[model samples]
Target: MEATETVLCSLLAVDLTDYCYRVCSRCQRVLPSDNNGLASSSFCNFCKSKEPKLLYRILMSIATDTSVKTVICFDRAATVLFGCSADEFFHFTKLNPLAASMVNQVFDGEMLRMTLTRPHNRNAQHMRVTSIVPLRSGFQPAIVTLTHICTKNASLGNCSTTNHTLRKGRAVVLDDPNEETQTALVADPNQEKSQKKGMILPFKPLTMTFHNVNYYVDMPKEMRSQGVPETRLQLLSNVSGVFSPGVLTALVGSSGAGKTTLMDVLAGRKTGGYTEGDIRISGHPNEQTFARISGYVEQNDIHSPQVTVEESLWFSASLCLPKEISKEQKKVGMDEFYLIWLRYG
Candidate 1:
């Protein structure tokens, strides 16, 4: 409401709506959708409450009501939410001024803030996308939806503050309107005297640089050392290649030559250095589907040797699969062998 004054529309402070953000069609304002209703000048009851919180609640409700099914968020978290770093996404796909607008518009045109990192025991990277999208039902009304997507490709860097705020489901705001988290922030010092004004930095993707086991432990200390040259030993040396669902791929290598990194990537673990290429769980790739379709199996045994192999695998399966089932699942298949025992290496 504090932008330029014009008689074309009345700008008012919007606090009642939980999904307090919207992209104006004509002017493309990232302000609250007070009256962004398709119809003239009227904001309905649904638009008032059916925003980010309500949409997520409804989606969860539907997922539970159907008990037999699963759900997902519908788009890649990286491109959808981190388009603010259109410069970086340029490394993946080129973005022109118009294409940038198109990409951002479909993604609700709000600034994208995202982060990607590898898990400790897994190979794949975790990318967190935080942006607001609009959910609609024909011409009825439109409400904002808060979306978060984690994906493959690479570990994200530059998203510490954002990740902290998102983990708690809140946005970080500064007390001093003119103070900056860093000098890069554009704050009008003169305006601090005339009331206060804060500039909004569109969200960007934070990268996580993952490292291999041998070098990963010493990375933090190494990065802190002065006068050391930056090297590609981490970024270009990814051993955890990408994988597709239902496709049979093999990660063949010497015992210590990084086969496990390949396996970890497919499992979606958060490794801090190497880049993860891509991940697709089931046919529908979205934020929500990740929780269900994505499951991992470590090679080590979690059961005692006294227990039979069938009993052990069954126990592991029960952790993810249904607890109640017919006796047909009782069957067992043994295919255990160590790398050194085989002659492939």
Candidate 2:
């Protein structure tokens, strides 16, 4: 009965009550706990080490159109689902008590691609989730989701004070009860003004210049057999261009004129061809850093037809922007992008 299967399913529910377990660090066996539910200091007969480590083990329900299954996931697959290591997530949950609920909220109804393994025994009760991958491009990590939840909760006047002790045995205070209300009462004029003017992206203006750019690919064997002496077929030759900031640049050419090839070389998207050129970004030689500042869309790129334009923009902003940015700011950026598209697209 040993079989493995892959399926596309929606995560219906998660149970976090017993989401983790303590294991012997050396032998990786389940460790016993005392009456208070704390790890015991008893010696391990397997490896004779007393150290214990926590590992994530999650129980979740996944469903397709008709059938549903209960799956057990170990640490590696659990990390992929939560987007953080087990120890880190444990510490985060301790610091923010709302994190567990927030995680469930974020993952509820999320689509996932999962690999499931059936046990060799015919009477096994649950399938094992060997791997997990989020199908949504805008999937947020557990920490990010928790932070957003905490911020939203605070804004809604649901803050509380808690005292915590650090690993160094120092006492720390978190979230004064009056802090949120006091901050809400006082508004920053500069922030308001900036909001009215719309958010500015954190990017400096850059210009790209290329001179004598040429591209070549290996000549096919069929052509070489036909008595062609050259071993390489040149696609572009001595092409020069400059694209400045805040300018519209268009490459116009008939089919087979190498317009797409030239753009691919400039954008560093060519995978199998040899390129020769002096391509510079703002007077500096173009390197891997160019990928961080530039974007290229292929002619055959496709998106989900079921998703609307606004939904696509929001998803892109959520995925591409740094986690430090607030959800409100992301919404604002999405609105701005929608307006630009309406005007130019």
Candidate with the greatest lDDT versus the true structure: 2
Model 1 lDDT, residue 128, Cα: 17
Stretches > 4 Å off in candidate 1: 1-228, 231-247, 274-289, 301-345
Model 1 misses residue 213 by how many Å?
17
The per-prediction tally of clashing pairs is 28, 0
Candidate 1 lDDT by residue in tens digits, 1-345: 111111111001111111212333333222234354332322233334322211210010010110112111112332333322222333222212222222222222122112222234332222112222322212111111111111110123211111211121222122222334421211223433332255555432211112222223234545657655654344224332223222244656555665675455444554465553323322122243443544567677458889985667667666645546443553322223223335564
Worst 10 residues of 2 by lDDT: 164-173
List the lowest-lDDT window of 10 residues for candidate 1.
57-66
The candidate that wins on TM-score is 2
Every candidate's lDDT: 0.29, 0.66
Residue 14 miss distance in model 2 (angstroms)? 1.5
Cα TM-score per model = 0.21, 0.38
Candidate 1, residue 337: lDDT: 24
